[model samples]
Target: MQSLSNRLQTQPDASTATALLQLQAQVDGDPSPAPSSDLDGMSLGGLKRKRCRGDFEVCALGGEVGRDVVERGLVTGEEAALYFGTFFQGCDKYVPVFDPSYDTFDSIRRRSSMLFDTIITIGCRAENGAVSSQYQALSNTTKSPIAEVLLGTTLPSIETIQALLINACYSEKGWMLTSMAVRMALDLELPDAYTQLCEIMLQGSDNVERERDLFRKARVWFGTFVLEHILSLDCGKRPGVRADGVAMRRCRVLLGSSARTTLDFRLLAQVEVCELLSSGDAGADVLLALAHDRLSPRVGVALSDRELGEIVQGTRIDLSIWLSDWITLVETAGATEEEKASLVVNLKIQRDWSEMTMLCKGLQGIGIDNVAIMSEEQRNLIRLAKISAQRHMSTIMSNTGLYLGGFRYGMDFVWAKCAFSVLLLLKLTRLLPESSNMPQLIADSKVLLAELSKVRGLNNIYFRILSLSVEKCERALKEDLAQAANPQNSGTQLNFPDAEMEFQSYVPKEFILEWSFPGLTFCWIPFDFQDLLMDFGSGL
Candidate 1:
């Protein structure tokens, strides 16, 4: 099995290959490199002496101690390139500076140690751990002196993006940092190069050399576009670029031939997903799309039951097709076992989330007051919702220790998914059959949250909110169970106009399912459910 570095070292871009050869020659020409003392401001012995325990123990080991860690789930080339493309696109000059092969101390002559150190710090968080202590260790390592330096520096364009990506990668708990990263990327004028390429392409250039340069530029712009779109969706913020933006139009050029590989394909698919969300073609997840708008302008947009059902069904079909093609392409592209597993888990979670969203939309439309006297179809929706939540939880559990030595690619996002699944399960426990294993599911979710909390940091306010939400859920469940035991006691009327409001308020506001960034900043604003929440509050 070729290593991530090796795979990245062999990525198919002809220009990248030539540049690497040249970079290798330049490094080789300098026989006497900087002294170790001056290089990272640490002696070789001192560098080896600093170590990390807990979830990141393997990564912090010495030549002997870290040998197993390095051999096992090292960062993949694709991950490195993805991050690179995500933030450093259009600026080819900074490519080698942040390239993965230069990740080691041995390759630290030209590159910044801050960059190298940041990768290790974030990578450590994804390490598979058997206990919370491992996660604790991972969190603490981010506070290391070296990491502190990198975190605090105001690097230039390329390094700024590099630093921002690291910050976003490590600070996965909240949208604040991620949103900040998006904002910073825009401020640096990162996407401007791609815009220029678009102009050049349309100017009628038959020059093959210029065409290749244009292709590269278009890809870079697309890379930045992908980052902006995904982060925008995740943060519930408006995307910097619109669906009909120049970047999207130029990005499709890849579909002509440049997108045959898995990475490019994923990028293209993500672009489409972003466009769908932006264009409000989100199918069953239309509520989420409207929420991302931040204004809740579509709150009044009404679809009849049949129309909504058709939309949901259409979405499911589209996602099914995308998922199927994604799987086949990844397998056919010769991705490693680890890569395949990671991608599959992420995809399955996406599917489950979609199902849950559809279920939620249907439930909201029906209103809680109607749930007690729901039609067969409504009951069926509840069943599917429970199954979807369960599938999401099960998939998450199966992939819990995915970071062990493999790529810790999506742990932060996975944490968010786990939180979402747990909240859904808590809500479903109220509606599902009493014999359902909801109690056990809820217990497992709490444990998962506890573990994730340790990794996110003690100061992470989002996890604290999640913990409180879980408690509120448990309390609500107990109260309901007690009420169920005393059937003779009079409760609120089944057809009361206010029943839905009561139900919405029953689930703690914290568990309201906003994908805001990590940490405490009272500035978090939620919109998708906002209109519904406001309507209920206003007695509508």
Candidate 2:
């Protein structure tokens, strides 16, 4: 088990020769102010004095010392072994700086694959400890370090790296360390390290599906790992948590499943915080944040003075960062347009949809109340802002749909299907509000599904798409009916008061259910203006 401890390296690379020289000076601080005089140390007698214990024991103390002596000899071995035993432990750490074969090797460099195979074959032979020592005599003594330092450091040349591809060569714990390494590399822009790690994962395993399993099924465990390592309260667009200053992993969890046991086609989302609270799951909160962030930029017209009074206000958890994460996640989801459309439709039905709808309503309540005190001009600006926000949100919603619809990342996720349904539903609630042109929007959205149906394994997606569209159409009419029947006591125009009188009679639950999703119409709506997007944007 690789602990997060692997993320830290106390001896960060010394970038320049001066830095390296400074470090060497620090380590040799106690020895002497400068190299021992002896007139350039010419009288130092073959330099037997300075060596590490591992090297010293073999040369100094020629006899196999008793355990007691061995135990005693360990205190500052370099000092004790040389002074007490008249022998040395340390060897010069520097390997030779040149290799004779380098010139010839350059000609064979074009056959890099063959050269690598031969080198690995030699390494494998050295796997046995005895063979390793014997082989080290030949290669380390003759070629290896000198060759590498000369080729990599001394000359202006491409440094060749040895890498192999392995998929799912990682365990839940392994991924955490790997994730930290990846993040650190990304932050520092360490091209060499990042490339090295990506190569290791690619060569270590061939199971992409297993890799995804670690993504969804192990999120809780993964979250545990992340929380342990990543601890910073200053929330930002980029994850701020770090393991000893190394960036923590960014986790993506799938909450819903729509396919068979071995195949899970569902909503995949990047959730910032994975903890759960009575208020909601961190993942759920992330969706709410995404919705809000997506809506922030748009300025909408304000509500009438009377309507503004109804807006209830309270502080909400700030999720400005979540919106940015969502934006990137959704935008990168699908490789194509039709796939994107199917994803949008599927996302609309995700589990978070219903809850998100409610959450958005809460936001609307606060917003409306705040605007209630404003004049008509203020209300108009709010209205436009809301309208613009609704449009922008639709873009995110659409992009999310496209991504989820295209990727067939299999499902080993436990309880993911249910959770996904909830998110999709919540997302839909936020995306689809009562629109004046609900029928046209529904029609427009249908074309997206039709385009998506061409993709393989997406027939069911089209079916779900159809089901949700039918549901949206009926709810639009239902909303119209509800408003006409009991108009808001706050003065507003009534569309069909006569029809409203018989709304209960005109739109029975059973009749709507005959065509749309069960319980969909009444699921919930967050902000009334969301209806305007479905009604207007869809037709676009």
TM-scores of the candidates are 0.54, 0.27
**Candidate with maximal lDDT:** 1
Q: RMSD, each candidate, Å?
A: 13.5, 23.0
Q: Name the regions of candidate 2 deviating beyond 4 angstroms.
A: 1-220, 223-271, 275-317, 325-355, 358-393, 396-440, 456-465, 471-540
Any idea what lDDT model 1 has? 0.46
| Candidate 1 TM-score to native | 0.54
Q: Kindly list the per-residue Cα lDDT of model 1 for residues 1-540, writing each as its tens digit.
A: 112112111122243223333433445674544332212221221133222233332122222321221223334444433433433321221121232222333443134433443444344434432134544543443344323223322222344345444555445433344444444444444445445544555665556555554444344444455554444555556554444332442354444442123345445555555555555554222224533332222456645556555655666666676567656655655557865676576566666776675556555554433345555665566677677778777887777665311222343444454555666666665555556865676687677675565554334444565576577656655665666787566363342223323333454334335563211111111343445668899999
lDDT string, candidate 2, 1-540, tens digits:
133324433233224233324334645664434333211211121122221233232122112211222233322333322322210000000000111223123332342322222233232222322134433342222233223222222111111111000000111122233333333232232323322333335466666554443333232223322322221111112222223322222223232211111111122232233222112323322233333333222456434434332321111222323334554555555435553444334333332332333233333433433332434553443333334334433543456444433322211110122222332333333333434344444454455445434433243333354445445445655666666686663244323233222321222332222111112222222244455557788895
True lDDT of residue 534, candidate 1: 82
lDDT of 2 at 177: 32
Lowest lDDT 10-residue stretch of candidate 2: 87-96
